[model samples]
Target: MSDDQSPEPQIFETLQPADLASRVADQVLRAIGDGRLRPGEKVADARLARELGTSRAPVREGLRLLESQGLIVSHPRRGFFVHAYDADELKEVYDLRECLELHAAEAAVARMTKADCARLEAQVQKLYDLADEGQTQEQVVQDFAFHRMLCELGGNSRILRLFDQIAAELRAGIALVGQLYDDPEEIARSHDPLIKALRARDPARLRAELHEHLQDAQIHVVQLFRTGAFDLTNLDKLSDDQRNRLLR
Candidate 1:
């Protein structure tokens, strides 16, 4: 290949015409989740279209989809940028996540099978392996996958959909902030209680364990936000009601 030639984009020949925009959105969302794209980074539709081997129309549609999910922002006149991080937003998202995931835990506990438990256990093991290897990005993805597996086990399509809506943003937030735990092994082991609770099919225990898990993450991210480690320019853009929530 020539020095200036870009590598070929991943082909999407098998996808139906109707799903083109969604495929584009997923690719871009993965890029954000994996930290290939950074917060507040400009996303050029034309550039993305060329890279994805698609027309600009679908790329524009994809950007709009990401914007609605709180992963991208559209600035008037300038164009789309990755959404900047905010502590208040992170807290709110995690609060809602806790509610949804606790409910999911209850549902999953009631219906969870041996296979489901095995899948979750394997996922947790992969997280430990990734952390041991010092693969931060892969660790982030595995962490999200473990929770996503819980949501899937709950068997509520809508609940899983709702969880997925924030998946990209959650991954991006963790990626942008760097490491959340001092010891990667400690981070991997944190999920053990939840797994044990799931195996025993104890809703109460699962709920308690899940709550602590999310709360610890919330506390960590809030500390990072307060320390001025993340971008907060967008916080000023929020209205009084929004700001009040942040203060609370």
Candidate 2:
């Protein structure tokens, strides 16, 4: 191929839809999730295509998929940037998450099983493990997974679907926030009450525990947003220092 010539555009080879999305998101989206790509930073599709040794076609498609997930936002003329939710918007997101999650908890009590209880216990253990390891982002992701597991146990398809729909945004928020709590173990230990309530098969207790848990999170998010702890003013590449700032 001549230097002046454009390379042929290549299409993905017979990958399943989920597989295709995974391949597409493997690099750029992970960068966003892991904080390599900061919120409000621009995503250049052509650069991604070149780096991935593919065509721009699938890169754009992948970005569209993320846009649908609320991980990336698109502007008519400005293209795509990592989605940045204001404090008010994040509070609203948490409210919706809490609403559906409480319902999921209520439904899960009647359906709780030994296996389900065991799984929840394992997840809680994982949270503590991750916290001890000081993997802040990983632990936050696990926290979301624990809640998501509860929804799955609830066995309500629509409710689970809705929770998954908003989960990506919530995960991003929690992972990047600097001060969810002063101590990471505090975050892990907080889930114990809910698990206890679940094991007892006590609807009233489970609902109260779950509600208080989510409400405390909402309060912190609102306070963090007010304090401007996330440094939204700078939309540049995530540096080690900046990432460390949010890691605790």
Indicate which candidate wins on TM-score: 1
Residue 60, candidate 2: alpha-carbon lDDT: 86
Q: Where's the lowest-lDDT run of ten residues in candidate 2?
A: 239-248
Model 2 Cα lDDT, one tens digit per residue, 4-75: 999865422333334454577645655664466767898887766666666777778888888877778889
| Candidate 1 structure quality by residue, lDDT tens digits, 43-141 | 988788777777889888989998988888998889999997677887788787888888987999988889989999999999899888986555665
The C-alpha TM-scores of every prediction are 0.72, 0.70
Q: To one decimal, what is the Cα RMSD in angstroms of model 2 from the true structure?
A: 6.6
lDDT of model 2 at position 134: 85
lDDT: which candidate is best?
A: 1
Q: Which residue pairs collide, candidate 2?
A: none
Judge candidate 1 at residue 196 and give its lDDT: 92
lDDT of 2 at 165: 61
